[model samples]
Target: MSNYIVRKLKLEKTPQLDHLARAAGELYSRTVVSFWRTVRKKNIWLSGYTMERWHTSSSLHAHSSDAIVQCFYNSLKSWRIRRKTDPHSKPPRRRRWYFKVIWKSAAIKLKGGKLRLSNGQSNSPLIVDWYWEKPSIIELGWNKASQCYELRACYKEEIAQPINDGNVAAVDLGEIHPMVIADGVNTDIFNGRYLRSVRRYQNKLKVRLSKLIDRKKFRSKRRKRSIKSKQKQLAKLNNQIKDIEHKLTSRAVSMLKLRGIQTLVIGDVRDIRNGLDYGKKNNQKLHQWSFGSIRIHLEYKCKKAGIKTVLITEEYTSQECLNCRKRNKPKNRNYRCSCSFEFHRDGVGSNNIRAKYLGIVPVVGLMARPSGLRFHSHIQCNLTDNILLGNPRDSIAGE
Candidate 1:
């Protein structure tokens, strides 16, 4: 299997590059608006072949134009699926003034230290200084946060053969702990307090900025500047959250690999927000939870390591006691059963998930206490180890 990673390169603003990108964006906007109109008037979704006919009219490389249409088609497809559950779900409607430009492998050329991106036969190609190896795909777009045009280079890498050990682990995801993995013999908890602190700060900052902006007169220069500043601040916080998540997942995968784990079973929480309607604060936290992103990162990272990931329905996995097979609602961070069974809440959930996946009744008595890991920063974590279960053997850095 192959996995792809993206690197962002901020472009040096030039009149020529700006003109080319704006032209491409205009083309994309026109294509989407036109496609939406056709769908509305004829009440029929245009096929890919039909969309390709308009490529000849575009000034961009044929593949680049096709990429824009393909993106619109993909959005429409997602809307179609979402509408099944939410009939009120809106389809692509608002017209974008500017959209990102994409260049497929066929239209990208790297020679010397410069990368060339074709723009069809009539126009000159766009070239940028590139110091790294060539990428499979190149994308150019304006970043509102940084107030600059950025380039994204996508590189595909082959997966390495993973350990063939018969050991398996199950992950229980949560808003508090983020990740808790339990193999038959060991459990590990990755604390998420750092993530929650930044998220809370971001929310407060957003509210404060929004109030400040609201007090200003509409269309005033001060208001516009405040809005721009808010976007930049929030974007930086978002990047920090993303960095933490990536590091947490990477560390989790590393620990699993070190333990010779071959299969990872993850609790599926896909529909957790389907009908959620808690109070304002509670609902906002749930909505902002990045469970889906976590799962995607874990899946792809595990695939790159030749470790298989299995998603199983996690219904009652956290509430049901693995020892007595009885349902007991957990309180706080602990799960206590009347039959004298007690353990960490997240660890219990992971153990139950593991049992569900392996089709075996767990002897919770033999399970080791979960090791705790909390991130001090994206690069380092503080670890509390259980000597009986054995440490991750420094696979993940710990103090």
Candidate 2:
């Protein structure tokens, strides 16, 4: 749960560090793309992409005199090489000789073994510092331009406080009420502004993109502009959603800490996208749910905040009633349980979700609260393993 970030600044009177960072990032991406294309067609192999290919027995680039070769051998034996993959693909990053020699050389040349940045000039040993109680290690990362530089000190904090006795927070992640939180009494709803805004932009983009075809611009120009604009629009929407979710989750988890909520009961929806038949309709709703994205963000954020998250089986959370044990058979957004359990369908589900955390369903392999709460009876739902809905264990259908 502990990771650090390395930040750098550009020398005064020079272009911003952001420019260099962006360039480095782009180069890195280009290199990976080239490597993938080469590897895919079997035009090159592993040696060409890593330190191995940099110094052959006779290759002078490595300065492989007996001493340098021996040094490399010993270094290889002693150093632990960790791997990183391409951000956008299944391909493993090919570590080249330039990275090995250049980084090592830079580190060696740096003052106190830490890299530095100067006026339009690269300095050895990029600088860094440590915060909290995490260990201090010199880690290297690839910048946008594919340059390998040491990322200096990382600031990471461990905020792990033990949960209070028998207290828990039930989190209902959704589209409308971006976050419907039940703290056993008052329900706080974080409005779905992000969702609404994103949907709006998405709709606008579709209309705009369609209209682009009618523009008087040349065919290639129009196509290129259209594609670029579409990508920009999508990225903007995604960032907006992510920012809202990040802020909302962090705020919510922090609230839990204040409330003495020991454990966070998170409802893990397998996939809001899969159950539906794929097409325009499914896509329209899927965009709004962002089920997978939000869940993933929350998982890591909660962990970092030291809040233990318990992912519950979302069986009939959407339909099961809290009062009167009634099954409302939801006709719309509101849940009118058959047994007349009056409340927001989401509220009833949230209650059941929380109950499960309190030991409501144990036999179903649901890792619930260690306390004495138990699962409720008379409900139905599933999507086992997310997609694979197992047989109904409770009286509910598709349990």
lDDT of each: 0.82, 0.50
TM-score of 1: 0.80
Which predicted model would earn the best lDDT? 1
Q: Model 1, 229-311: lDDT tens per residue?
A: 99999999998998799878877887777787899999999899989798888899898888989999889877865688899
Model 2 residue runs over 4 Å out of place are: 1-44, 47-166, 213-219, 337-340, 360-399
TM-score attained by model 2? 0.59
In candidate 2, what are the lDDT values of residues 1-399, reduced to their tens digit? 453333332223223333433433443334445555666898773333253343332222222122233333343334333213333333344433332112222222234433443222332223333222222322233432222343433345445555553577787777666666676665556667545666777778777876875563666876777766666666666656665665565556666656666777888776655667668865777666765666765666556555677888777777666655545577766666555444565655566778777865312122222211111221122212222111222223322
What TM-scores do the predictions have?
A: 0.80, 0.59
